[model samples]
Target: MTMVSDLFNSREIALGVWLMIAIIAVLFGKSTRSGFGGVLKALFVWNLMSWLAGMAVYISAFIYLFYRIGLWTPDLLKDTVFYILFSATVSMFKANKISEDKHFFLEMLKDNLKAGILLEFLIGQYTFDLWVELLIVPAAVLLAGMQAFAANDAKYAAVNKLINSIWFISGGFVIYHVVDSVIQHFHELLSLGVLRQILLVPNLTLVFIPFLYVLSLRMVYEEQFIMLSFKLRDKKLLRFSKRQAILKFNTDLRGLKRWVNRWNLSHPQTREEILVTIDAFKTQQYLEKAPPVVLPQQGWSPYVAKDWLPDEKLKPAFYDPAYEEKWSARSGNLKLDKDWSGNGITYSVTGTRLAADHLELRLAAYESKKLDELHAIFKERVALLYKNATGVEAPLKLTNAISRKKNIHFRQGIYFISLEKSIWGNITEGYDLIFTISTKND
Candidate 1:
């Protein structure tokens, strides 16, 4: 019969056209660049989804047209474009849209819901393929949920974990039961009038779920993204606090010469001020050597703070003048008294072992407010280098600066160039130096 031949011819043309399109896509979709792999992969997924959807939409439309007209003949271009539009509509529904984006999609969801419902109403329509469109929202939600979990921290983590867990558990059991037991009950109900039963309340309910679920998840995901951003900002301030303290200590130290020159040590309040400054600048308190607060009942981790320190005192360095005196006094030999640096600028921390225990230090004199700062800057840079250096191949040279906003400082009145014979032993006197370099006016 003519109807049968026409059906066969139409199907052949559709198949041949699809094959040709596939060849064209394969040729154009590939790339020559190395970094284009991700682009190609995304394109591949998009096209593959479009291709499958196109074929289904065209075939279903053709069959319905044939039954109505008693013959089949599909225009390749017309059918392909229509199917592609339908596929795009399906893809758009589940795409996660931000608040700024939702205005565009609000109209799209309305259009698709109309098309989906109307397609099922046609008597010979083979549009269970339209139900595939329903999958987009749920898939997007599941994906958005996963992204939320991957990057989650304190606050939103609890809710994100709960939704994903509960959804998986509930959906798995519910969907499986619907397929196994409810399918039979629905089948019996639908046997009377399959088309009407399929298109009505159940399908609307099913379609609505995926749509609402994705939209709700996207909203929560957006809110949490904002909260996480704020938390990271707070964490940034916490980290900056340590760096700020170091900079402040360095700045005050650079002012040493000014303070040393101006200090009225003969004043009535001199001793009391010196005592307070010394206590504040003590090595055990200044450095992390101060015992962390510990809960003895629950032993140690990194969090112990404000722990009590015992026997706080300074230890001698390799070149200490005290050792020369102690050695000379022991034997009946000629002893040389080494002269001290200007204004007693010494600082030394005493500990039996390198780390994993208490640290203590003594400064030359914590008398002048300006001079006391030298002890801080010297200890900060010196102690850091010492702790981190393990048997160095070469001697470590560390620089510390005391900064003034608009000026460079050398703490001592003069930069004494000539002293000891060797460069290592040169520069016996300490001096102030500015750390930061600024502009012309600066």
Candidate 2:
């Protein structure tokens, strides 16, 4: 068996080749078969260009850095321009669209490739760095995975037809893509009568390519996954905090209503004034389940499962790991947790839609305290990351841009809350809670 050092080192060709195949298998799953054939064809032109440029860069950069400071060769120019082009292209894609999908294409090639689905794939082939060559096998498989997983909301979901074909034909070995890439280089060097040491450089580079690519992509993938998880968790916590805050504000309405009732009782003739307060607080509001999200919730799949949490309370005795629940409750019909006196709102599957993607409420008769509580909770989330209003520099009036659609109103607490969650999406459904929070008639 190869030693562990041999496995990690890029210096060995066999190790590198084995690593490449292994990584490709992980990234593509079943798509490394015939699907790769199509990918190879599309990538053929790009690979030829990359080979021309990268070889030139390697030679030129090596020479310049070690020896000549002047006499820039055509290879230098080719490599420099290619690097600039690729960097610019990658930056443009990143800035152009916010990739909302949490799952990465892992494309190191396609956004789920058949030939080309996204324009970025076509652009990437022409513009990416030659170092990407090492990642070719893995990304090719990832492309298949991306095609498979892009639309899937679940873990390890099935891919569509075109991708299946790619998967079918992509299996067996790493030799095909490697051989395809290097055949010309090998042939050219033999014809040129290059020295033995120099001739092997390209092959050496090829060996190291997969190792480097996998390492780099793995780093990026991990960083991205961590960051994405943080944002999602932050958003959820921000919302939860909002719910807790509502309890505090609920008390305010109670005190106000009591004063109003007392005033009306003392005058007995000031009935109209008391009536106005009641009308405002007791008004019935209805929110029908947003048609788009008219489905039930399933559940969020967070990394820290419920079983992992410690049973005892947190203490200053030791640092505790951050906790996250894939779920929570609000006592409204269509709210993320509850539906009140109405049809309530529900978020769509994508969790992108706003306006209707919220639970509705009805603030009817003496429920001002509950309304205040709800509003207060909403306010907290709004203040925090929801509107992103509270932190750092103030943003424009785009507060609603990020707020979880927490649609609420009043007809008392019997409102319908529909929760097609903004992040987890209909992961919590089939439960209901109704409660009456007594408030002094204001």
Candidate 3:
């Protein structure tokens, strides 16, 4: 009876719960078949940093609270001071090392530290509340692990589904415990001798609401992928351009095989149609858009290239002034024009559409070594415009530099930006930019 009582004590139960969670993370919470070795390494390193930081924060809080309440004896004060110094020393050293390296593992330490501090503070401040220490801490740790795995894109579809399943189940458990905790705390304060059963509507509503919202978003992504896959299977993809369709539908061979096999099983006559569709997609030859294998010779000129075109002949694109003229002449009131500053830089803008869509712009910089700096300035301008337009407090704006490809795609506001580096290796020849406005209806 004494052993059982000791085993179920708050601290012991908390430790046991965390141990079980760590085991689960190593065994089933893995995102990839690459194995748990890397994840475990990251988890241990981050968790140790977290533990030290949390210890420093919580120990300081404990010392402050005890001293203020006139509960601090010399032994308690000495132990607190010792822990604070030790934790601070270890934390500072680890933080400095992480700053110096700046790897993903180091980046994850901040998240782990935040979670650990919150859990440890709750546990240390409310030491008698075994539910907070044992139940809440484990749930928080598992949620953080699953979130990190998904956020980092270290994903397998099966693992993702399993993680969400666990999320739903754990959410239910958390709701139950929270209600029990609230009831117990209420009884302690009110001195209630006995309690009747309580309604769970409020607890369930508060805890499970966010889970339902996120699950809806997950379902939306799955539906999108499924619809795209079906279109590829059916050979009826009108809405997406060839390039857009390819980018959206492309997957690894194993993934593609799984998709195809399942699709074939459901629609038996789709075998021939799917093969034909895939072959058609493969024959489209998107490889021609890739950058050159070897860098062109220093003196080589695109204008003097052996086989393509005469210097006078320009490719037909949104860049051609004549093509711009024809497009602008149409009924919906669109105009495309270029602004050339005297300094070898040009900015192109397409006229606004009535529906308020994403507009694409083409920019060219010639005979300049500050191409990167120029693009950075343009991206910053675009980010500001997006912020003002949307009225979002904190918007994520990023630019991806392309070296081995001709086209890049991303969205800011309604504007879908596609940057094409047609003559990138030799910037003397200049590059092209294209922006398309995605309409509200689309």
Q: How do the residues 1-442 of candidate 3 rate in per-residue lDDT, one tens digit apiece?
A: 4765443556556766687877776677546524777766765687456654654565555556545655443434433443345433443334423312325243443433444443343333234456666766766677778766765444555676777888899766655664566566754534211110011112222332233333333333344456556645444442332333335445232233333334433343344554554554343223223313322222111111211111111111121111322111111211112212211223222222111223333345554444555455445443443343333421332344433224655654543445555556662665554322332323
RMSD to the hidden true structure, all candidates: 29.5, 23.7, 24.7
* Candidate 1 lDDT over residue span 1-442, tens digit each: 4664344333334444555765676666645343355657765686446644654554456446543654323333343344344443444444444233345445645654565553333321221222342453355567677757654445667676776787688656545644554445654545424443333333323344344444434444444334334433455542342233233333232222222222232121333443343343343233334444533222221112111111111112121112311110011111112222332322222112112211212233222334545545433533442332211221222222122212222211111111111112233433332121111111
TM-scores, all models, native as reference: 0.21, 0.21, 0.26
| lDDT at position 267, candidate 1 | 22
TM-score of 1: 0.21
Model 1 bad stretches (over 4 Å)? 1-20, 27-94, 98-212, 219-231, 235-442
Which runs in model 2 stand beyond 4 Å of their true positions? 1-72, 88-162, 168-442
Looking at candidate 1, the ten consecutive residues that score lowest on lDDT are 327-336
Cα displacement (Å) at residue 15, model 1? 7.2
Winner by lDDT: 3
What lDDT score goes with residue 364 in model 3? Answer: 53
Higher-scoring candidate on TM-score, 2 or 3: 3
C-alpha lDDT of residue 204 in model 3? 22
Which window of ten consecutive residues has the lowest lDDT sum in model 2? Answer: 312-321
